[model samples]
Target: MVPSIRFALRGATLLAAVSGMVAATMPASAKAPFRDLNHNGKRDGYENPDLAVDRRLDDLIRRMTLEEKVALMLHGTLQAEGGRGIGAGKAYDKASAQELLSRGVNSFITRLGPDPRTFAQENNAIQKLAEATRLGIPATISTDPRNHFAVTAGASSETGGFSQWPETLGMAAIGDEALVERFGKLVAAEYRAVGIQMALSPQADLFTEPRWPRGVATFGADPATVSRLAGAYVRGFQGSADGLVKSGVATVVKHWVGYGAEPEGFDGHNYYGRIAKLDNESFAQHVAAFDGALAAKSAGVMPTYVIAEGVTIDGKPVPQVGAGFSKPMIEGLLRGTKKFGGIVISDWAITNTCPEQCMAPTAEKPQGYAIAMPWGVEDLAEEDRYAMGANAGIDQFGGVDNPAPLLAAVKAGKVPLARVNEAARRVLRLKFDLGLFDNPYVDEDEAARVVGSAATQAEADTAQRAAQVLLENKDGLVPLSAGKKVWLSGVSADAAKAAGLILVDSPELADVAIVRVATPHEMLHPHHFFGSRQHEGRLDFRAEDEATKAVMAAAAKVPTVVAVDLDRPAVLTLLKDKATALYGLFGASDAVLLDLVTGKAKSQGKLPFELPSSTKAVEEQHPGRPDDSANPLYKRGDGIVLP
Candidate 1:
């Protein structure tokens, strides 16, 4: 058990009625106080574990003032801009973090886990500060997906030394329900070890659109596959196959509905990607992908930023606004039809202003950092945006620290105080249910042993190896002989030596040439900060490209073996004729690849999605259709095996 500074009860006790039950008229000395929440001399009804969760929430929410309630509805980040990256701060920033805690905001989306032990220490300090507040509400630390192999910049951050596994698509490539669930449980153990109680992940978005920048994050284009794996992910993370548990990480299944149907493959983070082209059938399929996650009783659901264009639900035309600002998407669709009773958190920075810097770098703000995504409600004031989102059933606002606008809106009668209370109940219920109110601290020493341990990493390395799809092996050329003369590209010499392979100076001098390459993409929309980093446009490689040129030159002299990381499906027509062998990877280390090559580990994955035949076929296919392109170079589930 974690040791905490317990506050002693004072001289007298005050009998009070809370959650409609009167406390027995007795001395406070009858029982020991539970952390002295509300800093009272006696134990409150909310602090008593004997009471039910709903009743405890009722007692806590009624005690909270309007300011405290508003603060509960607003979630801030460790960073001011609310971006993604690993930050290893040995000490907590009192000026930046304490100010928010003082304002009664205890929840934050933190990206501070550099390692297990250091991350635990940083989180403990923050929780201690929350315990010092008047109500002593424990801090609920949340994070982006950080246990992945190849983390994306804006979508998911680096693994922070956690056990590295293949991307979600790779899990789909392997399609093992048990293995995926094991990965989830392992992730939960590591996260809890580091004092993180909430996970803002398990993105249930489908990879329907071939060119979508964030498609790699999804399981696959198939609704059933995505739904099945996403549910397994939530079940594992939340520690129950049915619902949330006390020792589980509260999982948030996110970007709810149609985030993967971007017409031009742009993300909703920028203005250009705000409109998602969705017909009625396409939207239904998209919604179906989240069935498994919803069925697993996930603790939280985040609305997507994109507006569902050309769509309707139950014969009613959906509102032509971003899902965050639309009542039909939140209150009607998610809560009413789908029956999702979880906390509804809005995506980050939806209410902030999209100034020149947000759109593009201007002369005055050349290094633009602040971001906003008020896609359809740009005309409204900041306070109006807050009221609209709250009324639309947004339980919490992510990325923004201050609750002044919400407080102002409530005072002006724009938003009802009752709505804020409801939001507070939903938010506080999670904390209480997770036993955060009881024990929020973690053991730092335990964290060091659990996170990134060899046992967990061995399981992940197996997944990475099993997820690689062997696309081609001409004349049974795979299972390369270890002693053969080999030339490497994107592979290290140490890894080669470990695999017992002889290395040569050039591809011409070697018996076989092994080259690694990534899927082809164009950097379109360079003006926007997110778009500049996004993988958009063409998926076919040109002859002038360095990797393509090297492949062409090497394959002419030796039996060239190519391994491409399939973040997004690239047209493999260019390499079909030239290469003797092709291996498609979602995420794998040089050693994992070498193990597969030397027959130490057997290749087991099939194509998660089809590889397109040409750039013209990519442009012509519908954004919401799965594997409907003209004559795909490789069909879905296509793979080869060594005899």
Candidate 2:
């Protein structure tokens, strides 16, 4: 027998609710086989799972207070210590989270321990707290990209026993939209297993600036390629054709518009984010990358921490403020023209008044001496900042816990109650569509079963091999014969042997020299470790840097193969002429690299972005444009197919 729960609702009820009230209809006896606690015989509008989502959402919003409505628009990070919530050194127990839920917050971001069981267990605890609330509003848990191999503080979390994959740029190297989509499906299943409903990713920003610190997270520089893959990625996460289903993870296509082009190649933490000379056509191409995603119905968007410079909206220049605070940009461009109605969340802490905490601060350098990133609204009061963002069409503020400021804005007449209700409606509507209220918990054993299964790892392995771009194989030096005596650097002795080659310590004793080197950058400090990941300013190597000198010295000795990890493009002009072979890697382990070199797998990847010949080319290119570097060393899509 087909389940009655699957039965569709029929009536003029939704139309009546749209007119602002749902009149009750009572049957003599209920056959719904569940509680109609309000005892109307027919379920109440809010309680009826059968009602249309719009009617149910209206029922809830009309019942909420100005404070509760405002509370629904704020998201904060919940820190956990030993399975217990911790905030401000208080016992912030589950009871405390339950209390907070009653006051109303439906979204949270958190990092869990590297154990899948612990992640599932802790998530269930939080969900139980939400279930006990007055309205039983299910909390949507969000997380940064956590399935990558590398874990940098504040940016990415380590794969907590989840299926590991290469960096997003590496996937772009493979140049296969279907593979990227498959990866998306695998990531979504793992996320749902652990109760993570939203992914703050597929970073839709173009990697036009090779030196931007966060370039590694992007899907490379070509708008067409990135656009195709971005759409596929969204479809992979949020189920295709039919919107987001239970197995899918809601995608928040991010850094809305453009965030990749930070002026002077600095990270977009402050005024350095002001982009210049951005014309209409260039703006269209940069945004083309997100076109597929927006068309695919991405559930949310996040504005970057930078201000877009010189953009005209409605025949006037856009206000030079952060994207979150600019009404012309958010309301005019994204909301009106782009036609996106999903939740619009500000990048973390955009509303904070204190400079020290607002700027990217490190544990070592706790006092943030760098300029705070309130952008154009630096002079506005905290309540006014919240008011401006809210009125400008931002649906929620990220990384803020308190609801007092927004509530104050409403009371001060700076923001209307209707606007607050509008934001609340969007947030609650998404929760209902995700079906979070029905089943928010996970089965601990099932989570362990699906997270890092062997099948997922095999796909990652195949992707790693597919992602290796063979840029140069001079004199047929690649696919080196298996029995060759090899002098390897940057790879361990056992790893060399695993590739079935004799390991020689000195270049003099070997038939050929194979050296693996990373694209080097000058280190800057006294900031957050995640900030350190950003390769600011010059993307070059001097003749005398110790690491560069050593790698060159290896090339100087014998026939050499240079494997460059293109985390950001390396200035390899000096090494290009000397090496017998060259390769570009996005992100892969030693084994994957060895397999490509030793003919275990064929090279199928290509350059996702241009590799500039000099830092001057990088500096001269327009930050807001795509594929615009001056005289790049290698053009986009450059790769050698093996004969």
Candidate 3:
């Protein structure tokens, strides 16, 4: 049995007593007032709160073994039961946390169990484990957008735990810079409350390709507009121009370079849809958002999963490869030209091998889906892929739990030890800058108090209302009387009545009819539940289609209003002549739409992208260019205002 205290020991004596012993593994003889990391029997410079941030970071890095350094530069999320990415899982438990932390994982993708309280509790538990480790390095938690109502596979979460706001596209439609900033501040507060120090969001991808699956999350197609909104978003998350506040989440602005301009409008899941023929002229518009984000000093940036085909930087041709592995794009452009000092994380699973079916398993490829997006170097070994990305200037690996490959690469001389040290240093610097090392745990009571607050919800409602743009208010048919009889489809009758309109089942018996239609999409991966119907292929809808014809027939009988949820810029030519008024909504509630039409809220939104005049124009337009559709029905920023 060990003595309770070596009270008189100092310096050499202390070192001799604690040799080969880890502070965390020892039994408590006397409870420590403050943690004595490394069994030193006293606080070290790295553990000293008064020490400078860089000094603390250096001390900690110097003490870390190579394995620990590799762990610090790697990240992963808790897998759900049956291999799903979300939902309840044993992965959030202490055992799993210990396994990952013991391997030196200093960061995690957030995996809150159910509610805000649970989220706080689980994160606290994880932080406690980290605190007890030999180095006491706190794990920084990061997450995709969770404060919005839209759900996509592997992108965002369901909005039950936090305040629900308009999607990013909806926020852009409102065009209020101040309001956008407020939304960012609110999201940052909520994230901090739940112990999440990093935000993997504010997608800087331009809305150039209308048929692109992720446009619903972008801030439209125009460079200037998106650039402004992206900058405001970064400010909100990062706090004032000076630096981050305690509540701020270090925003990781994403898909650096051009992810939205996929060839043929397909997503990054396949090789055929990579970014191709990207010249300086077209590339400038795509990088505009990143430039804006960089100006705000975003904490980090994420590369795209698809390869950039034939793209050039500084008049030099870039090899065809994913942004994570491309030296010219990431090193030449983002680092050298833009002079970005922030960490660069590869998109999820970019270093893994592409299984037969990339992405979540679907009925077409039932073998099980996994997006091993080793795009340009599909033939390279997995370890070599990781080494290549790190050597190319990527600082961290996303979606990887094992650090053995990185360790092996260093041992084999594929990646220099100095490079590993540099990568680990960048990641640690972010943690130190965010103040996570000092206090990584959150207050549960505070989390409950601030998350989903009434004021925040009201602001979301206002923003949603503003995002509803009047596209074609022919004959001033809007602001229809509250007492008017209304026939509605895709809207709840109770909600319509609450807006002061009398609900009617038949269009012929009603004074006016309203129908809500979603932009049509072809189903891609049906088996991935939340990720299914990921719209791909054609972007047009015909009037003669069964669903379109039925809605039009009802709309023909009375003065009609149509609202299209423009996830993608849909062909609106068919409904132009038949409807009395047409509106565009990115993502909103039934009551918010009623509020706008009933004059309770004014429409301040403008078109973020063009509405193609016909399906043929959509087919003929270039995927890499924005606002190039021939004879567009409505150009970018076009919004009809009615008295």
Candidate 4:
């Protein structure tokens, strides 16, 4: 006799809760029956009894109708309609949320404010809304990478919550997989405490080029290193348990296929052309990291907006004139070849930018552009976004404004029913695997206690130690005396507002000025392609440069230290000559730097990529080129010792 659906669900929930209790009681080393055993990384295949759960999930999914299934595939973010605010605002209040749910919205992603209590309260409110709905479909709250330092907005801002750790690239420089895993585990614990079930992070993208602003979020350039770190991170964040609890929030390994290989080191910029003779090896290496993630059974994969060569769907290339809707690339490469059975998510607003003709409007038309003057393409329409993304096997739509159109399209028979069911099944399976149905809530009091707790603080401290990469410390130039009346300059330091050597009111102040440079790609107008060697202008020096020079001249009177905050290494010729000492702080926090300078913590990070001396050098050893012999700068792995 077939088991009752409700009975099976109750049993599943009980089993999951019991497993959580067991995990709390058992020692970390003791092997419980529900502990994940495939050891291949992800929770794929029927290796252990957990396979029974998969069958039950399939049974549950099979019972759902086409409309209900389609609803499950739509995941909504709290981003405002005009991109002005986060979370459901006055315009999108609980009533609006209820309306969306009535129209078939299946999932919701909420942000955590800086205050842990506030975050919990907001989450509880959202959860209450979900419970009030007819289907009782649980809301899955996801936050930005909040493990260390708050990235998007300040903690006081509505979008902020959780202590920020060092950037992922900084973590990679430590070269400690164990440390990476620990970071993930701590992040997971915080998420669990807050009732957040999914973390849209551990950006598995490789940092092939230093100039990419987002590179700081990646592990490093090496595929193997990224893969190992990514896998370990998945294991750490997702927990090693089979039943649930003490297990990790589901890990969403992101920027799915190819994203890290943007030309000229900028994200969401020009796609690498087929004829550009780009570094295919570097591009291929990105897949290696995803392979690691897949092996670990990362809960989800996110695709990027960049187009890759020879990657197409239905004979159409991707991210090009008319290719954002490519099917083969999404289904064949990501799901088929990678054997990824998890959900596939598109990057923010990517689907909206689909279709060849869609363009985002701009004020002016630049030279050498193919499209009309000043008009930007809106890649994919909202309706087309759902149809194309779902048909292409995308399990969920992230950051989508109004999912009503998508649902209406499905109801009108515009989208295929089978496609909807397939994507929905994956989403349900993940929720089930996460044990969301059984333990859908988190302890609000416990959340406040656990977030940034002593244990998490310790882990953050460890991450700080691992993330410090000393770019240059010539002849023991570092470890400066704490009490010395040192001159510090730069927007970052000046923002601190301490007394020292002062320069002009601008960034050019100090006994030492730390200048933050723009990413290389941002330096160019949108029209310039990768091969353009035109150095139309010299590097723009900020007031900070003048201040840095003044400080260096005054260095004879008093010692000076120049701190450089960078995503990649760029030559500051002024620093080469004027400063008493220069140090490169690649996205390290103020506290981390303070600890390093004051000897509170040791700087142990190493360079994860090469630092170019000049734009000329960058042009010579262009990222798209096959050879690296032409560049003159610090080779990969070049860094100074702080001790």
Q: Could you say which candidate leads in TM-score?
A: 1
Writing each residue's lDDT as its tens digit, candidate 4 over 1-643 gives 1111111111234445655665666676654443222122222233233456667566556555555566666666554323333453322255555555554564766653546665666666666555444344557767667654324331112324465677776777777888877778887887877777887766787765445555566777777778888887887888752212335788777766556555555445332221111334555566777776778778877766565554444354444321224466567777777777777865554444322222322235322222211102244455765676666667777656455556667877778777777777778777666666545667778878878888667667667755665655555555654443344444355433342223344322432333333322233434432213222222322335554455455554544555665455555554555444555565556556656655567777776666656666655554432224245355556666554
lDDT for each candidate structure: 0.83, 0.75, 0.77, 0.56
- Error in Å for residue 31 of model 2: 9.2
State candidate 3's TM-score: 0.92
Which residue pairs come into collision in candidate 3?
Answer: 359-370, 359-371, 360-369, 361-369
User: What is candidate 3's lDDT per residue for 485-512, written digit by digit as tens?
Assistant: 9888887788898989998879999998
Off-target runs (Cα >4 Å) in candidate 1 are 1-33, 80-91, 360-367
Q: Which stretches in model 4 have alpha-carbon errors above 4 Å?
A: 1-52, 55-59, 79-92, 112-114, 148-161, 241-246, 269-280, 310-324, 353-385, 401-415, 491-558, 624-629
Worst 10 residues of 2 by lDDT: 1-10
Question: What local lDDT score does residue 579 receive in model 2, on the 0 to 100 scale?
Answer: 75
For lDDT, candidate 1 versus 2, the one ahead is 1
Summarize candidate 1's per-residue lDDT along 1-643 as a digit string, tens digits: 1012122222213212321132244445654445566655466778888889888888887787778888899888765223333233344564466667777788888766467788888888788777767787898989888877655555776677799999899999999988888999999999999898999988899787788888888898888999999999999999998888999999999888799888868888988788888788888888999999999999999999999888987789888878888998999999999999989999988988777677666555642456789889888999999989999989999888788888889899999877988889889999998999888999999999999999999999999999998998888777887698999987888998899989998998999998999888887777676777778887887898888988998898999889998889888898888989999998899999989888898789989899999988988888876777899999989887565
Q: How many residue pairs clash in each candidate at the backbone level?
A: 0, 1, 4, 30
- lDDT winner between candidates 3 and 4: 3
lDDT of 4 at 350: 46
TM-score of each: 0.93, 0.89, 0.92, 0.76
lDDT agreement of model 4 with the native: 0.56
Best by lDDT: 1
